[model samples]
Target chain A: MSINEKDELLYNMENRDVETPQPRVKRGGVHRPFLFGFATALCLVYLMDLGFEAYKFATLRETVQVASGELQTSWPPPPPYTEVARVARYVVHISDWASLATISTAAPIKGFPFANTASVSDGPVGLSSGTPYFYISNLDFTGKDLLTDARTTVSLSEAQSDYCHTSGFDPEDPRCARILLSGSIVEVKNGTEEATFARTALFSRHPVMKTWPIGHHFFFAKLNISHIYVLDFFGGASDVSVQDYYKATPFP
Target chain B: MSINEKDELLYNMENRDVETPQPRVKRGGVHRPFLFGFATALCLVYLMDLGFEAYKFATLRETVQVASGELQTSWPPPPPYTEVARVARYVVHISDWASLATISTAAPIKGFPFANTASVSDGPVGLSSGTPYFYISNLDFTGKDLLTDARTTVSLSEAQSDYCHTSGFDPEDPRCARILLSGSIVEVKNGTEEATFARTALFSRHPVMKTWPIGHHFFFAKLNISHIYVLDFFGGASDVSVQDYYKATPFP
Candidate 1:
């Protein structure tokens, strides 16, 4: 059609009033086909919503189903308690932050065991490297403490996530699970292959770390993981030998 | 009115067809008054929904607002960096759990700084005691560690909540805030006033603590705050005198 004719047709389509065909009844504004199309679109949208909800429910099943409240995305159901080493690694792998305990050399409270919260990574999302890496600056107490004494214990807990809260397990409850990696925490030298891997592992989980101010003297450090301890059941703490802990896969 | 007459009237009200009057058109069915009533009801419901949403946003402001992302209930905007004591108390008061650092006497890593996750309460919600109380059992390594040496430091972070993460602050970033209350963690003598307060402080936040196994020998313990250190700004850590820390109010 010519441009003027096409424009005229478009205007008619946009501005024309829908006609109702009933002989006696007055027109109710909306056309029948348009109403039918709207209803069909609603049904399609509803089905898409249901599909999306189902997808969310399936992928986020890590969230526990609590008896009396809203659901939360949870860590993978902790491995069977009998699989001690696997449970330990599961706690380590899911935790993005850990508490590093170091002997303080700072004055007054000098020589005391000081705990500092440190963001950590074992590896990226699906890959568990079995070693906890830290992005720390010398200005912080934990970093300063490490400068004086490298001995530290990195603590990870299932309580960090919604798992324990939704499951009704107290943070201190052994059933809630806690993992401790004890050893010397030493800084990885710049330009080393391990440092590169540590950067990927940490920055992937905490993207904002890369933008931190350079004046803080941030460096990559890791736990030597000489000893492993896990609390996952009623009986007491479990000791997972370092050898077995490294061999176990957190994701089953 | 007679029962039958009242019933007949109710039936007419319920079953009568709504009449729409017009000049040349046949009945269009719905009554004008009924339509007006439905529209008014819808308006009221919409207003109530808006009010409820506003209430939720106001009451749960602890979650932070980031430049890009869904809004979250933020913690009270953190105190200025200059208010060192208030900032320290703020971290301790809002945190329901903390990482306790103790010198381990456990066999494998004897004499190492071991960190354990502990559910802590400074006081019930809105009541800041400035002292962290713990519901710990002897079965856990922390309990055993306490038995050997009471010297410990309780570490807390704003990162424990969604505030830091949502605000894009890395957990280790000093601006994200960390508080270390250094002192001895000692058990309160049973049946004392302090022990009763400690129970209220802990169980109020962690209701499940009341149901933990009885054989575990759980007891109430408090951190005797001797030194307070807060890392909230770029320069380095700030020390809030113990007296000043107790005097400051977290919620202002």
Candidate 2:
């Protein structure tokens, strides 16, 4: 370690203080050992837990016992369910993926509701616009369906989030909270400011999209939040105004 | 203790012989402490891991750090992604709940695609028929939406499962596997054999469904699978015939 870093570490170790209330700049390097130790302990506990689970599996009937599935976590805290607008924005902000339901364009299945899992984003990282955007390729069925029928709704669940699981709420439970954005999913007009914003929003959240084959005819489609359904409580679904949905600040 | 019970425990404990593997008749009660100890250890480890997660939260920036969401796991292992039919059935059978999408009936958003999260089941616990059934309330939006438009899709993702997380796959990753069954959803006529099977399926997996408010005008609904879209591989999504989907058993 550098002499300066070594001196800083020694001083912090001697003080052993969280209450010292150091400035934010100094805070970054300090207490790293405590963080490391804490993380290590946690991982050890998780590993042991995994071992114990395996042992239990060995004793159970010879069936594949599924392990506990926790959702992939992301940044930004969820808003209180009572704040429908904010919660709707929060869900759309943190969830990088959702099910996009579109009208079927193929023969025999025409007019039927076709649900496809899709990667999505509302805006750039650290900036959420409460509008969902998608990168689609004609090579994909969702893109085909979108082109034929622009009407679509992108539904996001707290099931796609850590909020529901951490709070021990069943994804199906009304209290778990879900949001559906209904409107025409039109391609962002090429070369428009919206298209630029959409591309940044999608590529930032789904980095792989940037590397996707260009020959596939990729285009950006966004859900114009003409209608919003927010299921945040037990009384059934409530209508969330598009204005409020877009206005609610997820970061705050 | 009865002589038979004591002898059985003595033999099993002393032998610790798993190779012989006896019949179900002797399965009622045995090696409970070993089971209990195993369970307790697992629980402790899980709690410590949870504690560790919480501690990490304390040190991070005050953003809503989504928790690591672990999907609820069950048995009878998942099928290979190559077996579209088997994989589809496995995802549905193991996932106790999924998001159901339907056409909305409300005046403002009427005709717009509306999505709702729901608890669903295909068949009785051991008799999965690969048909999704739902217990709905007329008092809720989903039932109303269904009434207006039975054309709906029930979307299931291995993301709602432990499979993806265990395999270290992102939910958005094609390898994570997602299934979309598009068709008409209809009310399973009460007193029919199918209704009976549907109830057993729904209740067995989601026991709490049995106790939901009766006054909510709850009834059973099942998706008449007409088209199946299985995305379990990297190349792209492929169509799975409903027949193959139903014929492919999850256990196999």
Candidate 3:
């Protein structure tokens, strides 16, 4: 039969109830003809559907294979450094204020504990002009903390103003900036020229140093500059330039 | 003296310029006093800023620590499959024709060596009961290509009449439905009872199968089921149940 004829036949069979045999079957007897015809129609339709689905699956597999092969053969290796540099610059933010700390060690002892009181400055090298200075009393706990430990970290950023009303200050008013230089305290001996030069520099840079009283020992703590972290509202610096500036030296 | 008195004295000294001294020369340089005063002010401000920053950092650090601890302790375990079954009835689109192929052992397969044939269907699962069967001969290269690589994909979706016209068919005709299936051929098997059974199951649930022929010794090739996309324009198969009705029996 032609394709059209075959389809018509199937369609007719699908709509019609199956014809029974010449002898009448019992009323409750299985509706055998209907069941058979329905089953046959369902089977035909299902087989046809599978045929179509298989066609679709095969086509996609071939496309994927071809595309994958083309990808494997393509060219110049991708750039490496460009991506890394892009990521580094994307992480910097800014605010205000910072604290810096460094490690200090005396001659006899090694790996002393951390001390919290010391003046930290970003100023001139040695006793030169424009040197930054910090002043702390010898009796302060931070000073004692610094005496044992030379290495320290300084944090820089803004203060949260959540309790200005309770503290009797206007929330809008700017608060004092705080800088903590923590490291071991070293006494500048009377006759040591190098230590004296350093002491002179510190005194010149800070008015408080000159008035701190005569004969009071000024110990110059050697700074362990490597452990410094200059954290601003912006992220901390890992590069050497910011570290050296905090240490008040060209080199550690 | 009060803090105001000390400040006035410093301001007066700061405004003065240095001159040649007579009996005993001044120990410090001409700019020393000014530098000292400025450095002292800076140091105070810097220290204050540092304190504020430290407090902020400590607070943030504590918060993060607590949050991390909580997260670690309160993570939920894996969910049961019962949750997955809740949304299982959403209909997924399948193409009009799904070609199935049996991979030919004789071909030297490079990427995909399977030889197959393409079959087109009227709708998603299979042909509907009353739809006319369109003759899609293997003689057509589109049909031929699909048979060669049973892996093909076809889409039956709404499109502008122009697109349908480009496919060499009249889009204006009510009987016309957009059918696009492309895939590679996997295999071509002889018509058999087992094959008939498998085909019935594949097609009954699939709208496309109803329009295709059955019980004919025709090419049965595997379809590329992955990435089967469909867009139905005449709203075909929307009312058809998507349940796996043919799961137990060979035919639905």
lDDT of 2 by residue, A22-56 (tens): 55322355343334444555566778779999987
Colliding residue pairs in candidate 2: A64-B76, A69-B70, A69-B71, A70-B69, A70-B70, A70-B71, A71-B69, A71-B70, A76-B64, A77-B64
lDDT of each: 0.78, 0.73, 0.29
What's each prediction's TM-score?
0.76, 0.69, 0.20
Per-residue lDDT of candidate 2, residues B32-98 (tens digit): 3334444555566678778999987554322112121223433645666788899899777766677
**How well is each residue in A1-252 modelled by candidate 1, as lDDT tens digits?**
999999998887776654323432223854333344445545665687699999987765465321101111234677888999999888888887789999998988999999988888888877899999998888777888888889999988776665665456666767878898999988889999999999999888777787878887899988998998888987778889999999999878
**Where does candidate 2 stray beyond 4 Å?**
A1-72, A189-193, B1-71, B75-77, B124-127, B165-170
lDDT for predicted candidate 3 compared with the true structure: 0.29
For every prediction, compared with the true complex, DockQ reads 0.21, 0.16, 0.01
Q: What is the per-residue lDDT of model 3 for residues B1-252, given as tens digits with 9 covering 90 to 100?
A: 999999988986876554433433223532333344444545665687699999985554332110010011111111121221111111111212111222222222112211111223222232221111122335332244344433432222211111222222222121223222223334434476534544553343332434444432234443333222122222221111113211211112
- Write the residue-wise lDDT of candidate 3 on A64-144 in tens digits: 110010011111111122222111111100111122222213222122111121233323222222122344444432344
Could you tell which candidate, 1 or 2, scores higher by TM-score?
Answer: 1
Count: clashes, candidate 2: 10
> Best candidate, lDDT-wise?
1
Q: Score chain B of candidate 3 by TM-score.
A: 0.25
